[model samples]
Target chain A: MSLLVVGSVAFDDLETPFGRRERALGGSATYFSLSASRFHPVRIVAVVGEDFGPDQMRVFEGRPIDLAGLSKVKGLSFHWKGAYGYDLNEAKTLATDLNVFADFKPDLPANYRECDYLFLGNIDPVLQLDVVRQMARRPKWIALDTMNYWIRGSRPALDAVLKEVDILLVNDAEVRELTQEYSLIKAYKKVRALGPSTLVVKRGEYGVALFTPDGIFAAPAYPLENVFDPTGAGDTFAGGFLGYLAWIERTDVTALKHATLVGSVMASFTVEQFSTERLEQISQDEVRNRLALFSDMIRVEDL
Target chain B: MSLLVVGSVAFDDLETPFGRRERALGGSATYFSLSASRFHPVRIVAVVGEDFGPDQMRVFEGRPIDLAGLSKVKGLSFHWKGAYGYDLNEAKTLATDLNVFADFKPDLPANYRECDYLFLGNIDPVLQLDVVRQMARRPKWIALDTMNYWIRGSRPALDAVLKEVDILLVNDAEVRELTQEYSLIKAYKKVRALGPSTLVVKRGEYGVALFTPDGIFAAPAYPLENVFDPTGAGDTFAGGFLGYLAWIERTDVTALKHATLVGSVMASFTVEQFSTERLEQISQDEVRNRLALFSDMIRVEDL
Candidate 1:
């Protein structure tokens, strides 16, 4: 199965309670590609610039990710710097250099148009809707991740995109913020009314919850000893999630539930180090080990 | 299968974002008995004063709970005043008058002495241990709930009690504080090393995690539209948990998991109103309704 992911591809400087790191290979597309590549061949559509180096390219070199759709524009790549407090859940943006990313017009490769699965990472909701319009054929499943920025500033565009996506992925707070509903159940029902058949609420370090018309299933965040950085954990979650769905060739409620578990396992690795440091080096065995942990963390006797 | 609950029976004044109530029926034992009575006849060992009236007793009067161990002493009943912020998760104690509960002693009724299950509510650890020693027959399972106050101020007594208990129930922050470990996994190991066969780390609103020698299991908090007041939610959880065990006539791991579900159902009701207002008026059908909701909330098919 082929998977298409569109979002930012850039560098990040992040600091957390565990430690700090300088400009590292980061961005939504980078983490998404790395995580999704573990399960299926991924096609990345994003714009990077001159600063996008060979070292970063090597991160995805041998993987089955096609960068034909990844553009190398002029000037510096998008750069973001952020710091997290002890909570490690909320990030304060220190700086953002959009660079070439400011004019990012995701132009999917001709071959990418027919990908079986699509993931629109956190970006402008209007742009996300445009990408969905560009797809040659309707993918088996289309999942989206969004931020408070769009939900607050571009409600119409977000609502437009929500009406088209098969799944909506968001953090706990953003779901509450978007729906103005404090209770998750009510918020989920409101999101569902917007058109997505499935809603996945991401709770950092806690777990993920999946809401489908059929039922609701939740999986706890795979417990970790240390969280070095939380940047891109959400996108990495989306990568593993959609990637697993493509790998299994199923988007039923059952597959979505299993995909939530896979997403949690991938996210646990993403937080162990800054950006994609830990995620880039994770092996299939490592993924399997974490999936085992996920199973153990959520296994309860039938009551 | 009789159950014994030893804790305070008090009057409480509470304020929440929703509203406020004064001199409401509240306390660890009050919530515990009201919830546990659903499964088995609960023998409550607690101290109240003249201030404790029929209005308060009415909360438990019709339930299958024995008041033989409830004592009324001189002066006012233990009085507590608290308020919850918009989050409804954090409680700020405005006032605490221990009153009769300050110098109280738990004298288990002769009929309660042979209870197979014991739930030691949040109270002085020394008093908790004293009740254990006074039991005519050793309970098959003894679960203890504690807070940071006792963990820091009464470590020795708490440690002694921990050695004698079968399970330890505490909040996530309390577990982190008690073990000085940032990760719940490490915290669980440290807690298990202290002697309990099982450990439950409760994350308010997020859900609860159970760690046993065999593995880990988790259940998300049953989502609700509004939380009027959170007082006594924890003890009510304990009551439902232990009560399920007594009802099933077993304390095995399977029973523990079922108890966790019952606990979640009970807590969903506790948060809906102040003190035992919602829990007091809850019916068997209401319990089943919430149980079905809990089931719907976590139901997921394997990929």
Candidate 2:
């Protein structure tokens, strides 16, 4: 099965309480491709610049990924610098150098258009919808992730895209911000009303919750002793989630619940080290073991 | 199997963003006994006063619980008044009347002395250790819960009790304060070093995590649409956790994970209404359905 991902491929400088890293290979599409390539062949539809080098390309070279859709423009790749305070959950942007990424347009390759699964990582919501329009045949499942920036800056575009996607993935705070509801249950109901049948609320450190019209299911974040850097954790989650659906060829309620777990397992590896350091070395056994651990973490007995 | 719970039984006046309720029946022991009675017979060792009436006692009258250990003093029962801010997780005490509970000295019945499971709810740590000493036989599992007050005002007594208990249940903030560790995982490790085999870090809205020498597990709080009052939710969680273990006769790692789920289930019911209102009307089916929902909430597939 083939999966298509659309977003920016960039370099980031991130500082956390643990330490700081400069010019780390990061971005939503970069993380998503690395994670999704583990389950199925991924076709990446993103724009980078001349500065984007072999080291970054090597991160996904051996994996089952096709970067034919990756376009190279003649300038710096999207660059971002950020710092995390005591509340690691929130990030403060120190600088942004969009360069080629700011004015770039996503052009899907012929093979990518017919991919079975599509992932719209955090990006311009209008562009996300435009990518869907460019598809030759509608993918079996379309999953999209958004952030508070789009929710505040482009609500109309975000809401329009929400109606076109099959699933909506967002963080807990963003969910609350979009719905203006304190209770997650209410916030989920409000989001479901917008368009997507499935809504996954990602809670950093706490875990993720999958809500559908049928009911709500949740999975806790795998317990990690130390989180070196939280960069790319969310996109990695979306990757695991959508990639699993592509592998299983199902997006039913049952499959979506399973996808949330897969997402959680993938994210656990992403947070272990800065960028995708530890995620690159994760074995199938480690993923399976953590999935089992997730099962045990929330198992309840008949009293 | 029999379980003994020693804590406060009081009348609480609470105000929240939802509304206000005056003189609602609440207290640590009250919630603990009600939840524990569902899994096994519970013997409550607590003190009320002349104002404590049959109506309040009726909450547990028909359940498989023995109130013989409850004592009625000559004065008014303990009255606690508190208000919750927008967050609802934090409460500010407006007034506290210790009343009969001020001088509480637990006198366990002969049968209660041989109980296998004991849950010492939030109270004076010195008195909690005293109850342990009064037990005829060393209980197989002893669980203790405490607040920041004892962590500050009664560190010596709290430390003494920690060395003797099998499990320590505390909120995340309290755990951080107790151990002087900002990280929850580090805090759990610090608490474990104090002698308890297991430590539970409760995050009010986020949920709870169990840390044992063998492994670690966590469960998110059951999402609720409307939280009428969060009073006694933690104690209710303890009741469900300990009750499940006492009923199944297991205190191993597996049981600890199961207990966390049970605790989460019980806490869901506790927050539905003012103090024990929803809990009083809870049916076995309700618990089973919630457990099934929780099971669904955490279901995920192998990637």
Candidate 3:
């Protein structure tokens, strides 16, 4: 079964305490596609620009990623400038040139209609809904990720998409910001009330907690000795989560727990270096080894 | 075997968003003794004053808590006044009056000297060492909890106690604050370098992470609808952890994981209301029920 991912594919200028990179390949869809493709077949629907060079495009040479929906318009790609210091939780945005992404619309490929799994990455919630509308057949599982930018401003559209999503993933502060509730559990309940049957609240470096109608599942963020850059780690996590589910062919509550652990491992790797560089380096066995350790970290005796 | 706890048993005036409590029965040893005594015999080594009323003393009437070392001196008991806004992470100290506690000494009863498990709650490092020195027989397991104040101001004494203790439990920020390492995994390693073979870094509202020579174990914080007051929650967690360990008669890696979950349950109960009131209200059945749910929350398919 194939996985369909839709969001931005852009050039990112990032500065961190470890180092700096100019025009590094990044975007919600880019990170999501790179990670999900590592596990299952991925079809991406996103827009780039003429300035997005072939060097960036060649990153797809060996991966099972169908880029038929990746269109190159005659303008600059979505370019974002961000910085991180001692605290990796909050990214300082210096600039954002929406460029070609400003008027972007997701146009899913015909083959994408057959995808068994779909991920709506962080983007305008209205566009997220548009991607869902374009789907020829409803995927078995639909996971959506959105940021505070949409929750605070485009909530009506966000709520519309939330009503349709199987899972809604947001970090700690974003959940609080969205619901205006100080307590995380309260915030979680409010999100569930808005319609998603399952909620995955990402707490970078702390962990990811999943709430389902059956019950709750919590997995700690894999403790890392170093986190070089946090850019796109969340997107990478969403990809890893949906990718694993697509491969296993299950989206039950129990399966989501495994997905959360898989996502943690993928995000752990992404943070070891900037952008999706680390995600590109690890093999399937390496991913398996981390998953095994992660599984061991939470092994409990049956009561 | 009995569990030995040593720290100040003081009165606290606190203001939280829920409400305010004046001169509440609050202290590390007070909370720890209340939680630990539920599982095993607990001996408290702390000082109060003539002003310490009979109502506060009756909290231990039916429990297996030996208050032989709970001395009532001539002056006022140690007093603390603090406030918390919506953010319960950082408590703001409005005033502190360390009347009798200023010149206090822990006078452990002869029976307490032979207890098998000893927990040194958050207190002066110099005083913590003194309690160990007073012990005629070394305990089977010694768990120590201290704040950043002692970690920074009394490194030598803290180090001395750290070398002797078997377990060191600290919250997330304290470990980072103590080791000056922003990365939690790195910070865990640094704390292990200084002393204890087993370390539990508590993440209030997030959960507990256990680090041993063997490796790492993670547990989620028991989700709560409300956290009325967070005062002494950490101390209650320490009591729950050591209490379970004392009952299980082991401190191995596996045992520590179970103990972490137990502590989480205990801490969860403590925060439901102000001070130790919630801890006093719940029955053994409620604790076991919550622990069962907690175990179920992380139960996953073997990978």
Candidate 4:
């Protein structure tokens, strides 16, 4: 069975110390589908404007991604312009024209509703909840990603969605903000109580921390000499993780660690270029080799 | 075999989100010795003052640590007061009093001269160079740790010593500062070029990363529910690492990975309480079990 991803598909104008780009193909589902498509078949439900031309949307054409639920509206596509300086962790928002995405009411198609996997990318909790309600058959596994925006603006809605999902993708600071706890372990416990049994806190460049009732696991990011643009790196990470889990058809302890590393590897590739350039072009052999390198890098034999 | 640790032994007043403590047994050599002494015998070469009374100095007792080279002067011991806000990565120094430590010329005891492993903690680079010069027999493995202060203030001296060291233990920021490079991998390469064949960049709370001429390895910190104080976590890490190498009598690729995890485990315990209270009392079984847990956390089978 395939994975169903619901989030924004938009254009991003980005600037970093390395260079700049204007109106590149960007957004949560756009990135997630591309990265996840590398491993498992992916379907996206997102809204785009008429301005988002056929050529701009061709990044998903040759991949195992179904755009059956992608909506092309009359207005401009959701557009965001941002910049990064020394610290790639924080994005400086130059402007955001959420013309089409502002009215994003996710409407899942028939095939989409029957999928076994679902990813509610960073979006309005109300919309995320609506998609959950539209599913014809409950997915085997569902992971949700939310930003600080919905947590502060729509707590009740966020809380309602949290109880249904199997995992919540959060950043270190956002986790603290969600639970009002400074300590991450405390934050992890509090966050799990809100919804998902599996909580993965993305720590930007440092790495990601995984928490389950069984125990906790921390995974480091693939160390890079340069990070061109950190934009969409998180979504790409989710894509890798969910994609791997979908491919393996298991979410056990070993699979969780494997997924976490794949997520980090995908994210490392995502930041090496603007938009999904690296993610789209990454070969299976390159991924296997890189994963092997990572395996060697962190290998430990018990004493 | 034992590790020779050279640095200050001081009193620390610390404030963190967990709580506060005053003038507790602190300093680089003190923490390193305490942590390393658990695995292999550790000989400390540094100076304290008469004010570091019997009760205050009793933390080192009942431990496999040699104090033959630890000097006691007539004046007060070196004192440092620091605070950690929401961001535990940075230790905001509120006070620093270098009393007897100011005149410390590491007069290594004759027996200390034949050591195989040497760890030079964050101190004046010039003093570090002097210790290297005074060694009766060059150590088999010499790792160096220097602060941003010496990097900025004593660049030439730091450079001179860097050329002689086997490895350099740098925190992420100090490496960035030393090379004027924001990218960690690039910074690691630049630091390696300056000296030391091996480089380990310590990312607080995140993890410790190791790089040799061979390849790179990344190890995550042991997840802690609470990081009571991060004062000497890095030193403890070095102690565990170097001490383990001393015990195993190896620094091969597998050995380096093993040492990295041991370092992470030791640092984890150090952060659980103020000063070296946790490190001073941890059992071998506890270390073995914790290391095993970390081994499981980062485990990945070859793809």
Best by lDDT: 4
Chain B: TM-scores of all predictions? 0.97, 0.98, 0.97, 0.98
Q: What C-alpha lDDT, on a 0 to 100 scale, does residue A17 get in candidate 4?
A: 86
- Span of ten consecutive residues with least summed lDDT in model 1 chain A: A293-302
TM-score of each: 0.95, 0.92, 0.97, 0.98
DockQ of candidate 4 against the true complex: 0.67
Q: Could you tell which candidate, 2 or 3, scores higher by DockQ?
A: 3
Q: For each candidate, C-alpha RMSD in Å?
A: 2.1, 2.7, 1.5, 1.4
Residue B62, candidate 4: alpha-carbon lDDT: 85
lDDT at A122, model 2: 93
Write one digit per residue (lDDT tens) for candidate 2, span B104-160.
998888878898899989999999999999988899889999999999999999999
RMSD of 1: 2.1
Give lDDT tens digits, candidate 2, residues A1-303: 679999988899999988899989889999998888888888888989999888888888788988898999899999999988765787899998998889878887776778678999899999999999998987877889998889999999998989888888898778888999889888888887888778888888878877887787776688777787888999999999888888988757778777888888899899888888888999999988888877665555443
Tens-digit lDDT track of model 4 for A203-224: 9888898888777888778888
Query: Which residue runs does candidate 2 get wrong by more than 4 Å?
Result: A292-303, B74-76, B85-87, B97-100, B109-111, B180-186, B252-255, B296-303
lDDT of 3 at A182: 78
lDDT score, candidate 1, position A111? 81
Candidate 4 regions exceeding 4 Å error are: none
The CAPRI quality class of candidate 2 comes to acceptable
Candidate 4, residues B1-303, lDDT tens digits: the string is 658989989999999987899988899999899889888999889998988888966888888888888889899999999999877889899999999988888887788878789999999999899888878888899999998999899999999999889999988888889989988779877877897888899998889888888888887788888778898999999999998999999878788888998999999999999887888788899998998888877776655
Candidate order by DockQ, decreasing, is: 3, 4, 1, 2
